[model samples]
Target: MNFSIARRRMVERQVQGQGVKDPRVIEAMLQIPRHLFVEEAFQSQAYGDFSLPIGDRQTISQPSTVGVMTEALLLQGGERVLEIGTGSGYQAAILSRIAGKVYTLERIALLARRARRVIDSLGCVNVNIRVTDGTQGWDEEAPFDAIIVTAGAPSVPDQYRDQLAIGGRLVIPVGNRGDQVLMRITKVAEGQFTEERLIDCRFVPLIGRHGWQEGES
Candidate 1:
């Protein structure tokens, strides 16, 4: 399979065709090798317009979804970005290409380890992956320029809002476990944010203290 050709087709169709206009996001999508993030068995379908499981019941989101979410962050380079749910580290790699640094969290240890290995192999030195409950948000690295949550949550977690720098943007999917609306929140001032619904989407439940319990449906 000609992965480079497949990648360009993905960015042009699945990503740009989905209404993602950010040039940086488009370039990142083209540059990152999506096939390397998925398991060998699924590599052939990595650039397809759909999600792929990456073990531990988590999935690497579709390329278009990643592009849309990354675009909503409104990154202008040299910004610290926080990513909730590292899954396969594909999203973080894309952010690393555009942001100054990326701090990504994954609750599943095995998944985190796997994602870390792949990210390291790509030499994304600015990307940091930690095994922790992403719902709580990374307080030690508070005031992120942008925050992106890959999992679906019942509501926007307060920690995410509090940890966001004023003027920072947060893109998250909020709603029921089976369905959600993609939301773009911008912190305009202290304790003040403006929310915009971007699109309807779906994702696995975000499981953590501030999210759905492990046993909940």
Candidate 2:
């Protein structure tokens, strides 16, 4: 399969057709080789519009979803960004092209290590990956300009709200296993938040403390 051709189709039919108009976001999605982030068996489907399972039962999000979420960030060239559920590190890689600094967390140790290696090999100096429960929200790097939760949670964790800088935005998926809604929450002021629903989505449950507990796994 010629993955590059499929990738271009994704950009034109899936991403751009779906309203992901940010030129930078589109360019990042187009430039990054999504196949490198997935298993060899799934390389042919790398740029398809559907999510592909990676490992540990986690899946990389669809390209269209990634593009829309990135465009929603409204990055101003140098924004500190936090990403939860760094599956395959694909989304984080896309963010590195636009954000100033990206801190991504993963619950699974093996996936985190592999993602770190791939990200570093690509020479993305601005991205940092850690093997930790993402629900905690990287306290040392609190007050990020933007936060993105790649997995679905029953509700937005309070810790994530605390980590946001005033005027910052968090894009997260909220709901149960089979159904979820993508929501954007802006930190309007200290202790005040404004929310807008972006779209409906289906995502794996976010696993960790302050999220779905380990026992649930």
Candidate 3:
């Protein structure tokens, strides 16, 4: 498969056509070899603008969603970012290209280890992946410039809001199973958050402290 051509079409059609206008986001999407992030069996499907299962019942997000969410972050170079799900490390890779440092957390230990290898193979030194309950956020590294959650949560956890530095932006999918809304929460001031719904999406439930429990699926 001609991955370059497929990625261009994905950006021109699935992403830009859907209102993802951030030039930096588009450039990162076009430059990253998404095929390298998924398993060999699914490499051909990498740029198809659809999610591909990675393992442990998780998946790499669709290309358009990744573009939209990254654009929503309003990332400027040199900002600190926290990613809630590191499935495949694809999204984190994209962010690494735009942000100075990316601290990503994955709930599944196996996924974290595999993604770490994949990320390292790509030489994405700006990204750091850890296995932990993301619902708690990375408190030790709190006050991040931006926080992005790749999974769906029943509601925005208070810890995520607390971790956001004033003026920080958080992009997350929130709601119940089978139905969810992508939301951008902006921290305007201390203890004050402004929420805006961006789009409807379906994602694996965010699991861990303050998140959905196992068997809730």
Q: Pick the lDDT winner.
A: 1
* Candidate 1 runs further than 4 Å off: none
Of candidates 3 and 2, the better by TM-score: 3
Cα RMSD to native, each candidate?
Answer: 0.6, 1.2, 0.9
Candidate 3 at residue 199, lDDT?
Answer: 98
Clashing pairs for predicted structure model 3, backbone only: none
| lDDT values, one for every candidate | 0.95, 0.91, 0.92
The best-first sequence of candidates by TM-score reads 1, 3, 2
Per-model TM-score on C-alpha atoms: 0.99, 0.96, 0.97
Error of 2 at 144 (Å): 0.2
Best by TM-score: 1
lDDT of 2 by residue, 83-142 (tens): 999989999999999999999999899999889888888888999998898999999998
For model 1, name the residue pairs that clash.
Answer: none
- State model 2's lDDT: 0.91
Angstrom error of the Cα, residue 53, model 1: value is 0.8
Please state the error at residue 123 of candidate 1 in Å: 1.0
